[model samples]
Target: MVSMFRAASVAFFCVLSFAAAIAQPVKPSATTQGFHSRARLIGGGQQGEHWLAGVEITLDQGFKTYWRTPGDSGLPPRFDWSGSENVASTEIRWPAPKRHEDAAGVAYVYGKQAVIPILVKPKDPAKPVRLALALEYGVCKDICIPANADLSLDLNGADSERNAIEAALVKVPLPQALAAPADLSILSVAPLAGDKPAFTVTIRAPVGTKPALFPEGPENWFFSASHPVDGDHFILTVEEKPKDASGPVSLRLTLVAGDKAIETEVSLDASDLPR
Candidate 1:
C-alpha cells in the first residue's frame, strides 16, 4: 500500500507539470503574429492623378520584415484592396533592401520598420476616395511569423508624419536610360540546364562603384549571389522562370551601386527559348 501510494503521488505530479506546460501561452517573439500597422494619406504635390499613402509597420527590436523582393528566401508582403470604394489601383513601392543571412537563409530585409508606400488612384478622380486594405506580410527574428492587418483611410491633407513617408518614397528606385551615367544595364542573358529554366545574366555599371544585383520574378523563381568579374561588371545566376512556367515571364532588376541605384525589367518567353 505504501509503495502504491508513493507511485500515485509521483504520477500525479508528473501529469500536473505536463498540464501546466501545455497550458502556458507562447512567448511573443521580437515579431509576433497580427502585427500592428495603420493606413494614412500623405497629401502632397507630385501625387498627380493618384494620392500618396502608406501602411506603416513597426515591430519590436531585433525583428525584421522583407522588401517587395525578399531575395533568395522570405515572405514578400501582399496587399489586396479590391473591396475598397472608388479604388482603381494600388501600387506598392519598395525602397532598397538590406542583404543579410539568418538561420532561414539569405534574405533581403527592411529591419524593424517598413512603411510600404502605396500609390492609390481613384476610379473617378473627381470623386472623393476611400481605401480599405487587406495586408499580409512576414516578420522575422529567431523564427519567421506571418502577420496581418486591415487598414482604411480617406485622402485628405498631409500630416506632420508626411516627412517620414516622403523620406521612404525618396528611397524608391528610379528608372534610368540604359546608357545613363548612373544606370546599370543587362549585357547578356544565357540559359543553364534545369527543370525550371535558369539563366546567367551579366551587368555593367560605372567604373569603381561596388555593385550588387537583385532579380525579381514569380515566387518560385530564385536568384543567386553576385559574382564579380573585372571592370565594373558582374554575373548573376537566376531562375528565370517558375516551375512548368508556360507564358512570357517578366524579370525585374534592381542594381545597387554605392549609394545610388537604378531599376529595369526584361521579358522572356518561357514557352520558347533558343540557347
Candidate 2:
C-alpha cells in the first residue's frame, strides 16, 4: 500500500479573546486572507520566560493544509518571523498530523483548521515584544493552491487566548521512548532486505485502534509514508536518497493512535537486516 506520486510543487503567494472578565470574545490579530483560507496571530500571554503565541489558519470545508513534513507530496507551510521586534527567536511546535490521501499522493495534513502554536523568546524580557509572521502554505481539496499571509501581534501579557494556544500545544508530539506505554507504542523498526532501502515498523496499541506512523530522515533522503502491512505492522519505503547515503540512518518517527501520539528517533543501520 505504498502510494507514490510526483511531488507537487507549490509556489508562494499570499485568533482570539477572553471573557468580559470571562465572557468577552477572544480577539486575534488582523486576519489575512488567502485562497479559501484565513490566517491570524494569536497570543497566550506570557508563560514564564517565553511568550506563548500561535499562527491559526482556518480553511473552508474539505480544504486542508500540510504539516512541517508534508509526506509524499504537497508543500509544507513556511514561516518567516524576521519582521518582528524585540523577538530573539521563535519555535513553531507542530501538532500531530493525520494521514491524507488523494489522487496526487499521500500527505500528512490538517483538515478544516490548524492552530500552530509558537513559542517566542524575547530579546529583552522587561520590554514588550512584537511578533510578526509571513506564512506560505498549500491548501488542497480537489485541486491544490498556494496561499500566503502576513500577521502580527504585540504581546503585552494578555491571557485572552491562552487556553486556545495551550490546547493546541497539547497536540504537539513530545519526544518519547519506543515503548512508552503498554497500550500504545512502537514495538520495533528494523531494516528490510531489498534492492531498494526500506524498513518495517511494528506498533502496539489497544485492539481496534488504528495507528499511523510518519517517518522523517536526514536531508536528501525521502522516506515514503508508512504503509500498514498487517496487524500492527507497517512498511516505510525509501523513494530517493543521496548518492552518499549509505551509512547508518537516523529517523524521527511520529506515531499516532487514538488521542495519544509520540515522536521517537531511531537509528537504522543498513546491515541490521531482518532475518
Candidate 3:
C-alpha cells in the first residue's frame, strides 16, 4: 500500500511540475552589448506545436542597421544558431524597413529598435528548447561598424514579450501576388532599351501617398534605386551584371507607402519591351 502511495505522489508531482512549466513564462536572455547596440533573445513560448522567438536589438541614437539585402552598402544581419539545442529549424521574419540614403548610396534599414521575430521548430515539443544565436551585423551613422552579439534563452513557457513579438510581426511585409491590390500594387514593369540595361516599374498607391520601391535580385546583379519619372512611375537602371548573366531575371520587389507595404516577385525579360 505504501509503495502504491509513493508512486502516486511521484506521478502527481511530475504532473504539477509540467503544468507549471506550461503556465509560466520564460525569462529573456541576458542582454549582449556591442558597438552602439544591445541584443537579447526573447520568446513567446509555444504557439501550437512550434515556438515563437525573437532577436531584439536596440540601437543608440542616430545608429541604424541594414535589412536582409542592404542595397548599395552595409552588411545585413547574419544569424548563426549552431549553438542551439533541440532545434529542428528556425526562420527569421524581417519587418518592413525604410529607405536610408547616405554617401554610400541607398540602403534599406531599421531605425532605433529592431525586433526580428523568429519561428522555431523544436525536435521535440514536449522537451525544452535551448535557443542560441551568434549574431553579426552592422551599425551605421557617421561611420559604419561591425557588431556581434551572442544571445540565448531557454524557451519552456510563454513570455510577456509575446505581445512585442506580435507587434513586430505586424510590420513584416505581406507577400502578395503581382498587381494584387487595387489601391496599392505594381501596376506595370517595362523593359527599357538602352546601352545600359534598365527597367521601369510603375507603382500605384493612394493619392498623396508617396511610394518607395526596393528591388532585389541575384547576388551578381546590381540595380540602381528607383528614380521617380512622375507621380506613379519610377525607373531602375541596372548598375552591374554578371559577365554571363542573361535576361528574364527574377526580381524580388518590396513596395512601401507610409504604414502599408507588400512584397512580390516579378520577372523582367530584356526582350519584353513596351507594347
Candidate 4:
C-alpha cells in the first residue's frame, strides 16, 4: 500500500562503542522469531569475481522500525564498519518499506522481520575473509529505545550456507528496475514563503494512488508532515536549520500501488526547491 508517511524525519539514534571489550565479535544472534539481524557471505567461485555479503533484520510482531528515511519523529538505524581489512566496501540495499503511523508521527518501517541485503566486495580472492559490522537501530513500542550490536562472520571459502543466504537476499525487494515501464514523474519543487524554510513538491502519478516521498539527507532540516493538495501533488515544509545551508540536498520518492513500488530521486536546491 502507498503510505502517506514521509521518509526524511525518522529518528534512528545510534551510540558508538569502540572499546575492544565493548565491541564483541560479529555473529548471528540466536534467532527468537522476533526482531533480530543475520549476516552471511556469498560468491568466490571465479577469480576476480567479488563476494556479496547479506544482512537480514527481522522485526518482531507489533513492533515497528524506521526506514533509511524515518519520517518525522523516529530514529533511522545507523551502520558503522570500521577497523576491518580485506573488504573493499559495503553498500546497503533496502527493501520496500511499509508506512506506519503513531502518536509521535508517521514512519516507514518493516512491519515484519526484513532481510536487509548488503553487498560486500573483497580485495583478494585467495585469502580467507573476516567481516565485521557495528550496527545500531532504534526499536519502537510505545517508547523508542536504541539497540546496538557488533556482528562478525568468516567466509573461509564458498559454502552452502552462503549460497542460501545470497539466494534469499535476491528475493527481497530492491528499488524498482529502471527498465520496467511506469508512469511517475517529479513535476516541480518550489519554496514556500514562511517563518521556517519550507518547500512544496509537485509530483504526478496515477490518478488515485498515494506516493511515498522521502528526503535523502539533511535529516533534521526537513519535516515529513506534508500537505497534499490533490491526488497528483503535495507540498512539503522543510526547516531551515543552519546546517542545511551547507550542502546540496536530494529527496527519494517511493511510489507504491498494490505490490509494486517505484523509487525516483530528485535533486533540491539550497532553497529546498527543485534544482
Candidate with top TM-score is 2
What would the per-residue lDDT of candidate 3 be over residues 1-275, giving only the tens digit for each residue? 32343355446545644554465343335577767898888888678777999988899999999899877776689898998999999999998888988666788898899999999999987788999887877788976666667678888896879999999999888888877766778877777788777777888888887788888888667676565568787887777666666567788888888778888898876344322
Question: What lDDT tens digits, residue by residue, belong to model 2 across residues 1-275?
Answer: 32334422422121011111233223334578777998878889888889999888899988999899987667688888888999988988999999987676789999887899999999999898998776778888876676667678999988788888999888888787876666767888776778777778888867777888888988877787555667688888777766554558788999887787788888876444331
Better of 1 and 3 by lDDT: 3
User: Which scores higher on TM-score, 3 or 4?
Assistant: 3
Counted clashes in each candidate structure = 0, 11, 0, 14
Kindly give the stretch of ten consecutive residues in candidate 2 with the minimal lDDT sum.
Answer: 11-20
Which portions of model 4 show Cα errors greater than 4 Å?
A: 1-48, 83-85, 156-181, 192-196, 206-209, 225-229, 243-249, 252-254, 271-275
Better by TM-score, candidate 4 or 2 = 2
Whole-model lDDT values for every prediction: 0.64, 0.78, 0.79, 0.56
**All candidates' TM-scores?**
0.70, 0.87, 0.85, 0.69
Lowest summed lDDT across 10 adjacent residues in model 3 is found at 1-10
**Candidate 2 lDDT score at position 245:** 49
Candidate 3 backbone overlaps, count: 0
lDDT of 1 by residue, 190-242 (tens): 66565544566667766677767777776565556554566445444553334
**Residue pairs with backbone atoms closer than 3 Å in model 1 (clashes):** none
Per-residue lDDT of 139-187 in model 4, one digit per residue for the tens?
6777665556566666565544455455545544445433345565556
